[model samples]
Structure formats: C-alpha cells, structure tokens
Target: MGDQSDKGQHPANSPTPYAPYAPYRRPGRRPYSVRMTTGGSGIAHGFPHLDTVRAALAALFRRLSHDTVSTFPTSVLPVDVAFDDTEDVHLGAQRIARAVVHQLHLPDARIVITFREMEHAATVELTAGPEYFVELNDRFRRHRKDIGAALAHEVTHVWLHRLDLSFPGTRDNEILTDTAAAYLGAGWLLLDAYREHGPFSQKLGYLTPEEFGYVLAKRADFFDEDPAPWFTSPQAYDAYTAGRARARQDARRPPLAGAGWAARLRYAKDRRAAQDPRRTAGPVAGPGDGYAFEPAAGTGAPLRVSFPCPTCWQRIRVPVRGHLQARCGLCKTLLDCDT
Candidate 1:
C-alpha cells in the first residue's frame, strides 16, 4: 500500500515501534525511512480509520508481550522506527528494510522493501522486491492495521526465505506465510482486523476476508486452539460454517486408502487406458477395465467414475482405478476412490 499524502508526519522515538536499530544498518546499503501525511478529512474518507487500526495494532502488540508468551518464540529486540512526509518510493522502501534488519537477527539474508506509484484506481499491492527483498506501497502505510499486517506478512516471507522453506509454484506459499505470521502471533492483529472488516474491504489488495479467515483457521488448527473468538468478518463466519461441516464429514469418513492404493490404481488405469485404443476415443473402455462400464457414447471419454459430491451432490467423476485424491470443482470436497 502507498501513502496517500505527504504532510503532518512525526519523528519516531526509542520505544516507538518504527524506531530503527543498530543491527539493521548496513554499510553501503541505503537506509529505510517512513513518511506520514496529514490534511485529510472525513471518518470514512481518509486516514482516521487507518490511525485507529494502527493504535489497535500497537496496543495488541503490547498486550501480546504479556498475554502470548508461548505463541511468539522470537526474542523481542529494540527497533528504530520513523515516519516521513514524502512520497519518495526509495525512502519508504528503505524504512521497512531497516526495520526488519534491526528487529530480526538473520545475518545471511539481504532484505529490501520498495514502494511504487501505482494508478490510483488500484488497491494496495505487494511483491517480492529486487534481490530477495519484499515491497509495500505507500497507500498500504496509510492504513495502520494494513501496515502492521503487511509488515508482518512480508517479514514472514523473509523468514521463510532465509529458512529456504517455500511451497512450489503456487500463491498458496503466500497464504502459508500469512498462516505462519498468525501462528507466530505477530500478525494475528491483522487477522483480527481481517476477521472484523473482511479482507480487501479496506481496498487493500491482499487476501480476501474468507482467505484470511481460512488461513487463520488453519493456523488455529495447527496450534490446537479455537478460532471463533478472534474472527470478526461476516465472510469469516460463512467460511467457518462451511469448514465446520467439512470437518464433520471428514471425521465420519474412513482413513484414506494410502499410497499403495494410489500407486496401484494409477498404474492399473494408465496401463489399461494406454492399451485400449477405443478408450482414447470414447467414454466407456471395456467391462474388465475396473471402470463401471457404460455403453453410452456421448458423455465424453469417461476417464473416471461419476459420483455425487458429498457437500453439493453435483455429479463428479473420479478415476475408476487411479489415484483418488481429486477434489470437487464445485464444492471443493476431496474424494476417496470408494465413492
């Protein structure tokens, strides 16, 4: 997120969350800086809500120091914090970078934060900056809760980068990082906001409210806690309802058949499908191919057997003799081979 204006800024103090630290400074590296703006008005129009969010986050952080000792395992160190009244993207980027370097003790990693002037029509956007760095926009900084959340979110990314832990080729990696932050307790404040306001409702281009809630739920499950109280969004409520139903269904189902079943079925189906030229051309292959053979020809080549989705009752096809890990395209229900 990028800053909205360039006035009424304040200098950071020692105890301030934005204070820079000695460990964060690097020789020949540009320092990170922050700028705050003023002269905006209206409760729904500008920075007031953002300020409220920021104060809440600060209070939440202070409370966490006392209430969540077990949740956050990192050593709390002094950090140098500051804000600016300029839109110089380079300076804003440096400010975030300095904060991370000073706060965390990761020596081998190089961190950079960047801001860009995006079209006003766009919401807040974040991306991996140059050379193993993370970037946030000024509009993001304008919203205090979003700033805290974005910082925590990006910091988690840096932590994961340093640890060489990442999911392969999916946005799910970012979601995992968000979950990591909530699990670690730094970003649960953001999660709380998300639960309240719903994600992206503030025009921040991050996770949707349901997506945030889903990850929060996953984090709670990982830590064995009840997530209901922390949630605040109507979107979160709906997701929780759906998630609870799925959990109940999972509880009633038998254990998955295992890798042996997957391997056996995959090999069997592939082998049969490869050998039968007719199988390539139409729906039914043959009676002995382990598929429920139907002579109907217009339903397209039956690569799998059709079953009702447990959640929605939509007709879904599962490979008759292949790995049975398919999920419903409609209701997202995962299926086992036994129908």
Candidate 2:
C-alpha cells in the first residue's frame, strides 16, 4: 500500500486493472467462487460483497461498542453537502469535506482538500496527526455534486483508522470501510452516487449499490429513520428497496418469531434432527441455514440453538425453549425467537 493507491484500486469502480469491478484479487486473498469481476454490465449488482458486509457490521459493534454505534442516529443531511455549480471549487470542496468530518464526529480532525487528475474518485492519508490530506479526482471539479459522496467515504477512512478497526485483506477491509460509512450515517452519498444508463455507469465506495442499501436499511431499522426521501436518484432508491427487502429477510430467518411457515417448518425438522439420539449436534448441519444446534451444556440442561443476530450477524446461542427474547451482546439488539 502506498499513498498513490486509491483505497483498493481507484475509488471509481469502473472495469480496469486498478478498478473495483475488475477481476483484480490482492496477492494472498482468496478468489470469489462467483464471477464477481467486472463485465459489460459496468456495475456489478446484487449482494456480491454480502459476507464481508455482514462481517463488517459485526466488526463495527465489536470495535466501537454499541453505545458509540448508537450515537450516529442520523445520516448526513443533504443540506450539509449541497454545492452550487457556481460555487468556488476549492472552497466548496473544503466546505463539503468539513461537513463530512463534522457529521462523522471527527471533531479534532482537519482535512486538507485538493484536486488533481486521477483515476480514483478520492484518496485520504491514514495518518496519526489531527490533520489529513485528501486528493479528489480532477473530474470532481466539474462534478461537484458527488464531492460529498467522495468525502463521505474518505473521511470515514479517517474515522475507522482512528478506531483502529479493520478486516484481514485489502478487499474485505475496504468493504468494512464502506459498511462503516453507510451504517454510521455518512454513506448514503455512496448509494446516491450510483447512476447507470445508456452503457455509462458510476458507483462510489466498494459495496455494491444493493449492499449500500442493505447497510442503510439496517441503520434505518435501528434508528427508526427513513432515507427514502433523501435520494435524488431513482435507481439508488430502487436499489435501497431491494437491499432493504434483503435486510428484512434477516429477521425472518428460521427460529425468529417472525419467520414464515416454510422456514418454520424447516426449523422444526432441524430441531427434530438435533434431538434425535443418532444425530450429532453441531454448530451447523446444513448450508444456507443461519442457525445450528449444539448439545446441552449439562446433563439436565436443555438443548441449545445458535443463530445469527439479525443486526450485526453475530452468532447467538440460546436454550431450545419456546418464546424467548434474545438480546445480542455485541450490538445489543433484542430479538424475538421461537426456539
């Protein structure tokens, strides 16, 4: 990693050797089984970064603690980043940069904003100082509206760096950054930055548009906030809808009280398997199942089931008694379970 490296290739996720949509894998990271690489589609849609995104959410609660995570109850306001085309480029960029810093709660951090011709959307130096230098792609000089989106991402890098939280590799780590940006209230710009039409497309941040929506949806659910009215791009709203639907499904997984009949039926069968004397109970017995069963802790103790907390994806274990509310120790999200 060098200062020249734009947060995993250039921040602009176009298909290229240095771009995100390209089939570029870091040296030691394992390749995705799916063809998540860039193609004629331009922007890769769906939940390609899903696993990493979930892990990122868990990492957020783990590092920042639930109380700190709850403090970001509101997303960045549209007024905070508004830029008039007639506004001075340097001054306006600095203003937007400061807005991002303030919204992200980097009270002591000072950002030096500059623009130059570059392949990435933006880059920020992760330094120990109270001052950070951010270089924006020269294109942003003309496309001022997205300056907020770029700074939202780069400033979040500073926030995460300060928290000293990161994932293993470049790709997952970038996903963590993206997830933190969205869930912590500054990332809606990333989703709003997505615009695709007539073979031309632009997307900011590492998470796919849907993934951005998913994290946003998760944030909204926790804070009881709605971001639908903030999106100027219909495509972004639609992607949010799709991602929100997916996020809502997390609560409907088997063992959760809200689960549908089919899932509940499956859970019943799995429960039977766990109780069967011949079957060995373990953390997992099937693929695509969000839960597993473990043997009872003591001779008379009840059999226990383990499932992921819909909020942070942290695995939660509870006794196999019916109608219990489990609160995730990590994110502190309370859930209604029927195990």
Candidate 3:
C-alpha cells in the first residue's frame, strides 16, 4: 500500500544548490542564454537524435567505470538521512525539486505528497489549478535512494502539465517527459536509484535504466560535469554498461528508408528535432529515393538531391550540384557528393 511518513512537509532548512539558476533553458520557451549554432553540415548539440544520445551515454559510462574502484565519489548530493526507516526523505527531495522549478520562474506551483497502494511507484494527479498532488507507493519508506527519483518524475509531470505541450500520443508524451527529466537535470538521481541485487531492487522512472543513462550522459556532456563519483549502485552501473552496448549495436544498423515504416520514422525524427533551433528543417523526403525541393537562388523552385551515407547509411540532402563532400552529421562519415 502506502509508505507512511512523519516528514510530509518541506524541510525547514536545506542547503541551496550550487548555481540554482543558470543560462540553460528549454527550447523556444525563453531563458536560453544563447542559441546553438549549426553549420551547413547540420552538426550541433541542441536537439539530438536518438543515435546521437546513445553514443554520448556510451562515452560517459566508459569514463565512469574507469574512475570508480571501491566506493562512490564524494561529489554527488547526499541522502543518507532519508535512508533511515524512521525518517522521510520526500520533504528534502521536494525542496530540491522546488528549487529547480523556481529557476524557471514558474508560478504558484504546489505539490502535495501522499502515499497509496498504486500499481506504479508514483503517480501525479495533474490538474488545471496551481496546486497538484502525487501519490507514492509505501515501499519507498524502505528504499530511501529512490525518493529523489520518484519526486523528480512527479515534478516532471507537474512541469509538463503546466506547459500544456502537445504530443502525438501518450507514449510519445512519456518519452518526452523522460527526456526532459534527464536533460533539465535530476537524471543522475534517477540512474543512481536503479538497483537489481538479489531479491532487493527498485527502479522508479518513466524511461528504462538504459534510456535514463543515455539522456543523463548527454546532459553531463552539456554541463561538463562528471557523475561517476555520484553513482553508488553497482546494478545501476551495470545497466548503463548494457545500455552502451545496445547503443553501439543500434548505431551500426541504421533504419532502412522506404514509403512505409521509413516514412513514419522520418516523421518521428522531425517531431523530435522541431523544438531544436540548432537543427535545420529540410524538406521532408522519402528516405534516399527522392529529392528535397528547395527554392532556387532565383524565383524558380530549385532542385535538391538527397542520398544515403556510404558508412552508416543515414540520409543526407544537399542542393543538386557538382562534386563536393557532404558530411553525415549523425555518423560523421564523409560522402562523395554530386547533388
């Protein structure tokens, strides 16, 4: 059922986070200190592809594994007090989450924490009003490490709910939520919370442990912060390693383009990249079989040719011209071009 706790309210005293508010912000919503610049090669770091995200995670975990031998590094936020059976860590997590939301200057947002016997570890009761509530499973009282992650997930719902953002469907919405939690921050906690040892294990988040690693790695790369010191769970580390392998496998095999699933995949890619100003919105084409029509230097409709890369086979489009080299941004492969 529900985990009962005496500390249901926000902690009276909590240390302020370092750099509580900084330059980074969500795309198109404002507070982005600078726009990411993209070259003609369409290479930039703002809005990233799935494969791009995967590669970043692989690189991060490799570094983390090398740095840790016996104990976790001391740099991560501490939550040992929450681990006590008598203490409720939810209040502390709530304070931390509120600080994050405050950075965005979001208004009057209130989150009421409650416990229930729900199918999910936690669920948010989103509403149109300024105050919303979340229910957590009772098991979290014993699994203190998961408090931050659980609150992060519910807080993510609160953030997204306020924005009223549109998605293709519920699954896509959940994906975006997971991506936001990792990208905006709080991802490291989610990854650290993942545990699978003998009969005791807990994972509380929308994304799979692997997916969490991918986004967390990407965020870590953006901020230049090393999270290896913060990871305390061996099983969480294992999940990241496994995710890295999967990312590599996925990178080797690019999706085939056709009028069927290929077209649908392209649509999804566009949706993913739409909010990213660093990405260029090219004409929607059918894989590599057709040309993306572009307006000519003159008034006439100019012809643009697109083709697949020789290495990873990802489609690349450039205006129809003569001999030049086109770089595949996804895989960084050079293609001999005649478009």
Candidate 4:
C-alpha cells in the first residue's frame, strides 16, 4: 500500500480509521475478503484479510489495555481440548467448550454447545448473556478432533460481544473475532484445523490459513512461545512458516532502525527527496511496505515519516530529525528509529 492520500483525510481526533490505515476499506470496499469454505477446497492461501487482522490487533490492545493483553502469555495446551472417539459426544463437546471459555478468561460466559448441519463450521448467538448458545457443524460430532477449533471461534464471538469491540460488517466482524482469539491465545486451533490434501480440505473461521499463522506468530513472538511443533497438518505448518516471514518483514520496513540495507538505502533517497526545498511540495509515495514521507508542516518544520508499528500496526508519525525513539500509543511497544 504505497499510500499517497492527504493527511487531512484522517481527522486528528477521529476514532474511525481513514486514509493510510484503512487498507481494506480504501478500494471502495472488498466483497468479504474470504468466504467460509466448509468443504475446504477453496481455502484462501495468503493474507487478503491482513488489514482487518491488523485493525483487530490494535482494537484488542485499545480495548483490553497492554496489561490485560499481557495476561494471556500462554496458548491453550493441546491436552485441554482432546476428544476421544469412544467418549460421550455431548460430554466431550461441553468439556472442550468449557476449556476454551477458561482459556479466554471468560469464567462468567456460559457457552452452551450443540450440533447441527450448518454451512459454516460454527455459529454463536451474540446477545447480552452470561450464557451464550453455540451450534457446531454436525460434521464435528464424527470428526471429533475439530470440536475444539469450532468452539474456540464461537466462544470468542461471545468474548468480543461482551467487550463490545467489533467491525461494522459481518465479514469484518468475523475477521475481528478470529484475530482476537488467536492473539489472546486459543486461536492456534483454528490454524491447525486447516488441512489441504487431494480432494480434501477444511478451514475454520473467516481468516485464511496464513492470516491465522501471522496472528499466532505475533502472539508467540511477544510471549516467547513456539507453536510450530503443535501443528498436525502439513499445510497448516507451511502457512505458519509463510506467515512468520511476513510478520518478520514488518520489523524490517524502512525507518525502524532494523530495516535491511537495501530498504534503508531506498528510504534514505525518499528522505532526501522530502527534504529538498525544490522537490515537489506534496507527499512522496514510498514502496508498498507502508512507509512514506510528507513535506515539512511549515517553512522550517522537519519533514515527517509515517509508518506502521510492527507490534500493533498502528500508524506512527515522527519528525525527520535522526536517531529518535518512539513509542506506539497502542500496544505500547518502544522503537529505536533512525528517522
């Protein structure tokens, strides 16, 4: 997103995102970034839902606060969600649902789990409730193993509902729920549920496999936890690897001080252009990696650099003066930038 939009588009005091931060909403909106592929054959492979996912992360930090977010340092363990084939189906389902609710820190959220033939993996009734009703696809009764994944998603909907944190449309709200689950711990089940083989595929939630991996990787990096060894699906593991590369790339973007030599070289040239008194007096578009330079605010004010925080994806605007440290208002991650 080589953003060249005017800064005025984003009102300084406005809560809603506009201009550079609203990537998914910028292009006259997109038709539900990914569809629910219960059959799993059409499982999206990459990061189309990235913008909403990033926004969701920011929202979690904004709503829950950094201290509250830090409370979930551990991902849900595999044993907690296990379902034995010989066990009573209803007992197993309830057990897994309780585990997911506990992991989400929703002790008061009673999620009653049931099964039915549904086009989607699961659905949750999001009303004012200490008790929420959830319906899992009947397929999980036989498949058994994936009951954990479906419950995790539906339970998270209840969690988001209670917090009153959501996006406008159904598609974006679903993406938020998935991102919240993964980032708060318990979303790795959604990623691990994804499996693709000849004539067989299955994925849960609105996010693509890679998006889930990306969120999970973000959580893992912050908590110093590794989830790769827990993946049972080869395809899910591959998506996680690809997603990790994308997450790592965020820290390597220009102006962050850790940017690669090539990126630093390019950013330096863009910085030069912005500083040139004779240069065209407007915003200069950088590469697609979400960094750009704007002209000085006044005659002598320094030109500013705007970029996304690798942790929460919130846009940060800093002056052109070199070698400064900045802290993101959201997520509270400190950065050493040679701006």
Q: Which is the leading candidate under TM-score?
A: 2
- For candidate 3, report its TM-score: 0.53
Q: All candidates' lDDT scores?
A: 0.40, 0.78, 0.48, 0.79
Q: Estimate each model's TM-score.
A: 0.39, 0.86, 0.53, 0.85
List, residue by residue over 186-243, the lDDT tens digit for candidate 3: 5567667766556555665546677766665544444555556667888667666655
Q: Using TM-score, rank the candidates from best to worst.
A: 2, 4, 3, 1
Q: Better model by lDDT, 1 or 2? A: 2
Question: What is the per-residue lDDT of model 1 for residues 152-183, given as tens digits with 9 covering 90 to 100?
Answer: 55665665555555555434454445444544
Clashes (N, CA, C under 3 Å) per candidate: 28, 0, 4, 0
State the lDDT at 268 in candidate 1: 48
Q: What local lDDT does model 2 show for residue 87?
A: 70
lDDT of 4 by residue, 1-339 (tens): 222221123346632222122112123322222224755356777899888899999888889888999899988899999888776565567778888888889865444555556567776666666665666666776788988888888888878877888899898898998899899889899888888777778887888899998998899888889899989899889989989999998898889998899988888888888778788767876777688898778777888989999998888999988999999987788998988
Model 4 pairs in collision: none
In candidate 1 the C-alpha lDDT for residue 141 amounts to: 48
Q: Rate residue 231 of model 3 by lDDT.
A: 74
Model 2 TM-score, all chains together? 0.86
On the 0 to 100 scale, the lDDT of residue 273 in model 4 is 83
